[model samples]
Target: MFYFLPLLLLFMTASPNTAIIITPNEHTFRVHQRAQWKILLPRDYANPFDPDEIAVDARFVGPDGRELVVPAFWFIPGRIESEPTTRVATDEQLRQASFTVRFVPPVPGAWSMMVKVRDTERTQRSAPIFFEVKPAPPGSRGFVRRSPKTSHYFQFHSGEPFFMIGPNLCWANERGIAQYDEWFEKLTSNGGNFARIWMSRPNQLFETKKLGVNRYDQDGCAFYDALFETAERHGVHCMLTFNNYRDLVDRDMWGPAEWPNIPHNAINGGPCTRPTDFINSEIGQKLYRNRLRYIVARWSAYTSVACWEFWNEQTFTNVDIPPAWTRDMARYLKSIDPHQHLVSTSFGANSQHEVWAMPEIDLAQEHQYFGEGVRDASAPISAMARSLWEKFDKPSLIAEFGIAGEGSDIKFDPDGIGTNMHNGMWASMMSGSAGVGAMWWWDNYIDPKNLWYQFYGISQFAKQIDWINQRFEPVTLAPIMSDRSQPEIFADLIIRSAGGWGKSHGKPIAVLPNGQTSLGLPQYIYGTEQPRYRTQTILNVGIPQPTKMVVRVGKVSDAAVLRVVIDGEPTKDFAFSGLPGAPGQTKVERHPEGKWQAEFHQDCELEVPAGKHVIELRNEGNDWLAIEAVTFRSARSSQYADLETYAMKNEASGDVIAWLHDSESNWFNDRAKKMPRTISGARLNLSVQSGKTYRIDWWDTWKGRVIESREITATGGGELQLEIPPVHRDIALRATRIGS
Candidate 1:
């Protein structure tokens, strides 16, 4: 006698009739916990990863009599191999073929499951297995979800607010899982709860090598399993990023290489001949879908995997990601993933409204890297966060952020005083972002410098408020500066140009050696037609005195030179000498022969009198140099305090959370002095409920605790005035309404 269920039957294929053995890891499991079963099918089949050849699925009936179907994926058990320097472990594969079904039990009840194997000839069903699920323990908040009450915040299944507060743990270095273990422990201990992880480059779990076509790297898979397990243990939610633009491009900012090693290339007997082909071709889509199926099957059960980001800076890819591609891929991914995790993708500091507006992209994301011309890093973060939130009316994420795009600022600030890292975190949170700005350079700077305390401080402060139900809106603050004679310097990036490989006069030009071929350049320089190697603009010097102009040049090739011509009179040539590293050096490594030896020099300065004059920057040497950003110093300095304020108010209850930042107390300004000028007497004025009493707690952003407290009542004027305490760099304050 055989028992058959209609919904449970998936696919049947041809194969030799053989016995299927199923062994349960445990007969019972707790709700929200992973329930797995080991399965062995004794059948000889070529390409077990191909569903056309072999398909395996697990079907289960929950306590509510609802049927749930989950796919089964190949898994090979492995041991960890530790790297001596960082102790980051990689997988040492063991040769054994097996399949497993992993699922997180949703509810507490008795459930029954059956495994079905399908092939061309016949479909075989294993004996049904019964299991019990116990209720989850107290304080166990389920997976994160978009709060039903708010558009810009996240909440757990239990309706508790989940404010993400951590940096990007993109990939591990030598320390691998062990590194994550320490990192997660430090993060969670500091009250941090989120991390953005990339599934590309270094230790990616996908099939990238030629021999691994249609088959995932078993070692990589095992590494991820351990990584996720470690993350879950630390209670850190991971934004699992799938692909990066670097995976498709042959050359990037790092320099020339053999990117043809990927399995998708035509040379590897795959479907795509060009990078764009993968997004346009049917076969490529099919291949991607297969990979997605395997990914969801293997890792969807882990609650730690919060969001599924499709790509990291997708616009940087050689082929632009069409909205249809994102729409179709996201739709396909959602269809198979029973968990229905949040889906997102990122761009290079620009919003792709067409794609982000789609229902598939749950969150709008961008990566922002500021140049040296930027005074305060957090200013852009706050501006971008507010722009994204208001434009799309959705939660936003600054997925990758840093002082410089190329590398960590550790090379600049060797003392490791993380001013940019700290300010960016508080700024994003207060600026209506879904979470703190996820900073980049984790391995080289953040982790090594032990800056987990910054994340901890944000986390501690976030725990005091209800982000989901508060319905917080940004509040405009009126500041009363105590110091009226503080000299304020007006700084701006005067000349911004991108030099690499771009079309010039309808012809392709490679100005810088080892530059990315697909890199885009501005069509017109400063609104005037100009060649790629040169830019001309009229400088209407407004100040009455001489202004200092600093030309920051980068991406220099051998024998490259830059000349500034003012009023048709050319200045002395600024020559490059053996690519001396400074300003933008992320790492110290010798360039391979025949490739470009790039240099970073920011000391080229020129003084211009206050008058209207035409200025031109021309590459006069045999090679070329990129004008990254030209900064100008104003001769006239205004008197004002450099303090900045951002606040959010709960409309329903007059509660407010605010932060005050000393704009001048930044890494660039204070790194050498190692001191931030303390500001004494200041006042904050904001509107509140008239005649309402409120209690304010001023928090120390660095110490992660309350430094001062005060009680006040709003008068009939409806404006509450606060006497700001002595602030060094920045401070957080929470004003909660007292009584009804």
Candidate 2:
């Protein structure tokens, strides 16, 4: 972290002379809120070669007497040296020379700060000014923070899960803000806490944003100030991208048509003759850095700003020296900004370029859009998100993903329920994304269509669990095939336990949020602190008849208590028990420290009757356990043995539940299969302990209400297999284990 705090340079460098005074946003602020002040330096105090001497400090002494000192960087006027045309001022006259000192007090207190500026002669410190910092209003979490305990998620300073659920409001200019406000209001009101805004539109929030370059757009700053204020009012977090790739181009990609308005074109007197050179050009970088400095100085202290995204799809515009440019700009932003917000850059849909892997970025993000022929189902999308998650191993998001836009062959859907918007959110979460995949075309499609409820559904389900504290890999079971005339209602079987082994490992997989499963040997898990954990999975399997059966539970390296049952009766009544593997068990030691090693094997089995049965595998000791494959058998049962359903587990409460849906049931795949929507009797086979009772509950997606509820006993068989009501869109059911 190469910093630019000038006062810290007392042991070093030479000098200059300056007189500076302070202007504060407030003589006070809320805790973790900005306590800002501007330092007006004499215009002649400019020194391009050594700008650090003019650094200003925003100091806050807390009630506990703990002091925090932050450095203020200049919000210099940018210079593109371009031809002055319609909207911008010429370069030479626009050399911005000003300073502002800002800092956030993380604690409530009576704090005093003095403005200080260094010069050739001496250090000038103003008389200390006092201010009071109250605590922020309820629900404000200061700023989004990376989870300290896990690598894949984010939590608020308030420690609540921050699951983002909204689309791109990139064109949110003040020109028609009522729409943007409505969008923001609807989004926040419907559980959306995120938005991706672009600051690139010409004269939107950045006048010389693309064309003239260096000149400061005071109007732009006011626009952004209002933007953040609006976000704060709606309780929404915004990810503002400084520049999007399309802005670099002077015309459309496939043709030679020129955009007369783009000022950065070589014809406009800028250095770059093509979009590629803009990133590599010294003049462009300088102007960009100036803009970055201004952005940080102004918006860095706002709680509503989630991150400072550098470029939107930097790789697409053929930008020269991408890695070097991304690296340099990321560093520059980090150096001048006192508040270290998250940073990221994106690429075209479904693509992960070299830049997405850059360590300078806090979040690895990409764009993905699926049209005709491209599979648009949540499972496939989950796989897409998972693939990135597996490779990046950092906080990740689908910054821009959708099936719209004029250039895209895919047409837009006003009703997003059966569209990507609905499935995409669920898929993003299953694939282990920090927030929902941002759908493109917010104002045009999402708002007017009343599709905000799509987000409400996703957020409601997401709020049920803590993604940051718990790591979950997708739990995949064999597809439970249904007769053509039957309702192919599969079960939702999410692992409701702590920690995980990545999803998918050849047979049945436990996929990591990144859409990947770990190989044998070196392994990484979210529940590293807990030495051991147990899982009592109540699987829903279909059994054609009340025939004899053999049940197999994959073995873990640790000790376990695996059992099988049939309709509340111990399988022993059916005369069945499981045995450990021949080798017993084996675990791969983690590299380096090698303190903890997770073990695995598929050597456990039992015998039970073939009916809708539940399998319960408890633990005798420490918590960690992995059952690679659970196979129920009989002679020729391999053809009959199957697992179908998706699970959602809530750890805050000891409930591990799952939903029932055909792997191919989503509308996207249905379009491909040309499958008709038909209703049928779906069977739910859950694994329960012998002698236990349960309240089997089923929710109907169409009616959005509980359609069925009944109590049934697990008469000691360790399995409760039963038939469910007619399956419409899908079945969301829960078998709350009552008593044993």
Candidate 3:
């Protein structure tokens, strides 16, 4: 009987269990992108002799509603790498279990895998776990080929211009990943398509060990995974920044040291110099290379990645670097991930030429902070663009161009803002700038309520202009010179596209006839004057044949007479006084501002036969005139006409004030004392356009109190609303603000 009992036990243990269970009761594996799929069995078991006695079935599904099959396999402990085994009780019997099966998908995409086990007696299945397989990124499209030296142009998938309207995400604090998603989404919905994500050394992979900051762990990976996934879903591109400008200077600050406690020198201490010894050290180079390699390996497959910016504003501290080092760093990056896009550090506009000389850089990026008026703002930018284009002929981008409305004396001017941004775009386009990225979309990070609305307006306008594929062209208009007489004044005549007439395909020729046009005063200038001021007039000397011209104006009545002189002889004097002229006849239209506008068209009998004609205008008996500038395409010359000279009087003291300052502190006191006090309440009177930000500052001198120090966004003309806080006695108030 004992021999028989032993034989029965051996038979029971040897035979496949009527029921099976798997350890790690549940497991998750990413789908599509080739991840190994494994299943654990309750205990090591052999297949039963009767195939019908054992049943195994598995199925996998993806987030996109696609399903896949999982192959069945026997549980072999030693044959396959044995994972930790576990014991579990099923009803009355206890069994040992081991993991089984291995699966790997060749492609990438999202998926879920489920394994079901059943015997003749019962059926049970492991809980299904979910995972994601990212989509393959678009590597290189054949449409535009990129050379080793030339960088590839990026075309946004949304069918819009490659205009990046966004802000730099430089929050150095440990912001929870959940918060990042919310902020990132808000940016995208608000017209931002790109974000600069900083990769801190202390928080990153290798440097974490030294800094005592945890290295790239599951938590960080999960955060990044969610961030990248969310970005892709929202159509936002991330410019992965490896380090801050400060990191480039003092590498040891974030070096392998007490990391979390490692004070940020840029913040804790003053700006410090880059550790050249560390950078040149073998360990330093190795650390740098390893860090970069890890990042590339982890994110190279992400579609939301725009480009890898080597560092943020590397010139912030003026770190000296040998040419060899620059070449070496560029070469090192290229060697690791040749397919990844790259950008050099952004620098001041003046430093563009020197930065572009770096062989590893794909794009020349620059930052500028010009005031809101077009003419004053465009000069330096134009010069910078032209210089870069003439020297390297590479694509350039205005990486940053912004101005704080606070602390500025300038009032909000829509036309001025539009003109400033437009001029920058035109300059870059004409000077071969592939695109322009607006400085920011939102404002006042500390106070979300103070967000800038003008960013959206300007971005919308930019989309329209860029949609036309208008490239800036250099035109040599004889009488026009590029100069700005007043900070507020600006003017430029550019040919967007021309030469549609010749027998051969003629290139679009753009003529940039700037302030130097033969107008009486410079074509563009801003100044304050009495009720009557001299209006500068410009004349077009040559009217090419077969071309048509139209003139548009705002805020002026009594149209200027257009005198056309061909080859130094007076040919015709056409009067433009309305909209849509009559078959080449000059026409005029009235604007909402009660200003009569005039248009002069060539190609009509009213126009002189085109050869070489001088087109000129003079201000004749018009008052209160304001020209919004002009646009001429094709061969005709357009002139500024009908200058009305009128002075802005304070009315109280008959004083003309070019600028007005307003604020909360002295709201009542300042308003009571200023001229024209009785005419209106306490308010600053200044000519301002809709959709601009005006900054004002004031202090309560009487109480030694600071009262109103904030920005006021102007929606339209008239008195702007101010939130004057209660002024406390015995405290002086000093406040300052700016508008966009």
- Candidate with top lDDT is 1
What value does the lDDT take at residue 574 in candidate 2? Answer: 15
Please list the Cα RMSD from the true structure of every candidate, rounded to 1 decimal place: 9.2, 15.1, 23.7
TM-scores vs. true structure, each candidate: 0.78, 0.65, 0.42
Model 3 lDDT tens row, 82-108: 111122223222122223333333235
Q: What does candidate 1 score on TM?
A: 0.78
Writing each residue's lDDT as its tens digit, candidate 2 over 620-687 gives 43323444333333222222112225554333322334555433454455445555354454444555
Alpha-carbon shift of residue 337 in model 3 (angstroms): 1.8
Angstrom error of the Cα, residue 262, model 2: value is 5.7
Q: Give the poorly placed runs of model 1, Cα more than 4 Å off.
A: 1-20, 81-96, 122-128, 483-640
Model 1: ten consecutive residues of lowest lDDT: 510-519
Candidate 1 structure quality by residue, lDDT tens digits, 1-740: 01122432212232345768787778769878888887778665556677777889999889999778888987655444332111212223212446788998777899899999898888989888888889988987778888889988888876798888888998887778988899999999988889999878765445645343576655567678888999999999999988877878888778753347678888777778888787788888888888898999999998898899988877778676788989999998888786778899886733468887888888888777665535456656665666577678677887778877877878756788888888888988888888899989888998788888888788889988788888897755554445444555543423333221222222222211111111122212211122432433233334445677777765565445567777689965677633445335432334554434455645578887765555566656665455555546654333323466777889777889988887667777866675688878777776789989899899999988999998999989877788788998988889888998
Clash-forming residue pairs, model 1: 13-119, 13-120, 13-121, 14-119, 14-120, 14-121, 87-175, 88-174, 88-175, 88-176
The numbered model that scores best in TM-score is: 1
Candidate order by lDDT, decreasing, is 1, 2, 3
> Candidate 1 or 3, higher lDDT?
1
